[model samples]
Target: MQESTYNNMNAARSSKRWDNWEGHRNQINRILHERVLKSSSTDFCKAAIFGAGNCDDIDLNYWLNNVDELWLFDIDLESVQQGIERQNIDTKMIDKLKLFQIDVTGLDKISFFNDINQMLKDSTPIKKVVSYIRKIANNLEVIDDLINHYGSFSFVASSSIHTQLLYPHFNQMLSNTKDKETLMREADYLMSTLVKNYNQLLLNLVKENGTLFIWTDEFELSSDRGNLHLLPQFQREILNSNYTFLSKFIYNFGLKGAVECNKDLLSKFPNFADRLIDKTYDLIYWIWHYDLTKHYLIHCFIIRL
Candidate 1:
């Protein structure tokens, strides 16, 4: 998707989701308040959330109450405005909630999608497409104007968009290719490059000793792949199992192949295990019943840097 189209897609999705997810919203707000905001010692002068579409899973009032300034970044401003309107925040407090429209992935800055669409339009061979993505991946540089302009924040959070950064690109390529295996390999490389740099961007946004809260949908559940009926049992198993055991369970249950993004292969993204302090971080999982027919397994990581 081009940046404009992606923003429009986000706005449409936000409108549909605006009034739903009450329980999910409360759960996410509670987790962040208890596990990140309350646990941190940084002066609550500034905080920010990337991919803050419609801000459904956040308690806007609480954020305003805690931070002297709150920044919300999404590709579209309409959705952020819609989110603020939904919260019914006091007019006085509205001053503290600043909004920025930007693509956090920097994919738009590099015209990643546009290049690929052009290649496909020309019917470029799959090998050349693969090489193109690799070239872009190797040369990728995160846009830093956010830091240059607004400086760092006391707290930084990403609202379940790590997977989304690479999704549209993969879907676009998939639509034009029959050799899925070859495309998957290149998409995997691109996902790694995008996610890793995105992670670093999150880190860069945080002030020293501040906290970063990253949550993402790591796997899916439904009748087709892993029976959703077995979800309860699977959740129970994970509760008692260590990380190693959990990895084995995911593989044994055939979940590794079914996820939108396989956790084990993507630097265990969002978990940011590589940045773990003393091998410790706050981690939690919950089910997002996307609708009557679909469900997602969401996990969040709380890292204090």
Candidate 2:
């Protein structure tokens, strides 16, 4: 099939899978709380979740307990709306949370850069290529306003890592266009933007010696085997670049099949499942290997600023 056709098919499959995965809301929450959040600092007051899917999870509620202000952004409007309607996520809190519909993949547009430039002209020296940081900073302003209006928070959290695999898939799908090189350049641009944005955001939000925790799935590695390289590149950028390193905990054994039938599916099709699972496992392993094992896997970093 042509690349466009393949991408369309893959996009359809991805959408369907996310819809199905939404039902495992509680399990995802449990894992995040048990693994990622329990060890985080108890001094955060404002929190934000980029790529906040159907924000109906227990982990979020835990943050809401301590967080005076919350911000949630996602590319899917329907999912965000559904979260509001079904999850009873406090319209009051929702008002404070500042939900935004943004496609992180679309951060390459010049318009986005322009917006970033305008927003951050007053604060710091933003790199020319790192315009995407503006959106993060803009989002932070919302959180900052909340902090000013309400009070300080003791915790901040995001459940954005669940869709890490989509970055490469989207990049690959787009690369098949006639403008493959252009698409690749755009992917690089987007990654640069995110790294800058994340770095600045970390600098701004994390208190002096404050902690930040990121929760994400692992998706690529040499030993585990996978075809994609997008996330690996991004992960490398994070590690190689400037960021205080912390710790990486591999919940490999903890991630049993989220569903009871998943075991049956894995048992029946071990090879296929192994291929899929290995890609994710290796990605996680690589990040943890390079960062955690190297004593640099600290998703939870402390900033002196």
Candidate 3:
């Protein structure tokens, strides 16, 4: 698909619906603070968040208390604005942390347009066509401006919620393209943009020995309903190449016996009135013994940079 089309689709889909999974969000943040932040000596002064949904801002504020400068960037500017307001964070902090609405899928539009224009200039019809396409492609500047403004950060984080939504849009856009090789090439290019953006953010923001924390849903790795089964190699590559092992913890539901305990609580509170009671018990167990078993294998890792 053309870069312009992809960016519009990405922006539209992002605006429609996006949210942080509450249970998973808290669990990951807890592990990050306890295992990573507490152990590291480097005080994190700056942080950047991609897909900066409202809930995630709350999670970051709760865990990363030392962060003096916070940058929130997302394709959906309204969402970021809502997050800032909902969190009641100081406007000064919001000002210090620039927000950019950037689409990461438009890396080569300028070069492609310039090349096409130069090649077709002698033919009026071709020139007009190329000029139209160039206008469409050039709209990618919305995202380019984001990269220019934010530049980089010390800590960068993004949740898997983006991949699940964006990948299908990309796949659909490429499905009808005449050149299969070009379609695949574009797909790879977009993915590389994500990696490059993430890597550059990490490299620029993180101190030599700083940490990068990625919080993803446990279901992404589960066998029965997990997408991880589809790309086992890619999953392994990310874990192996990008991160160093620190510690893993589970949250929300407990490992094994804890699940059973939750089940029992549900049984006792079969009616709606017992909902709060059951939730309280589950919360207590999740906080205390979630890391002990394999059943609740919501993995949380602290990676050393």
Ranking of models by TM-score: 1, 3, 2
Residue-by-residue lDDT tens digits, candidate 3, 141-232: 33334434342445555543334323455455436534434444444434433444443443345555555554433323234444334344
lDDT order, best first, reads 1, 3, 2
Name the regions of candidate 1 deviating beyond 4 angstroms: 11-20, 42-44, 149-151, 173-181, 223-226, 238-280
Q: Which number leads on lDDT?
A: 1
Top candidate on TM-score is: 1
**1 or 3: which has the higher TM-score?**
1
* 2 or 3, greater by TM-score: 3
lDDT of 2 by residue, 42-75 (tens): 5544555654665543344554654566667555
Segments in model 2 whose C-alpha atoms lie over 4 Å from true places: 1-44, 56-62, 75-78, 90-96, 101-109, 112-154, 161-176, 179-182, 189-193, 220-305
Over 4 Å off, model 3? 1-20, 42-44, 54-64, 90-97, 104-154, 161-169, 172-197, 217-301
TM values, all candidates: 0.82, 0.43, 0.48
Residue range with the least summed lDDT across 10 consecutive positions in model 2 = 253-262
Candidate 1 residue 94 Cα shift, in angstroms, is: 0.6
Tell me how many clashing residue pairs each candidate has: 0, 15, 3
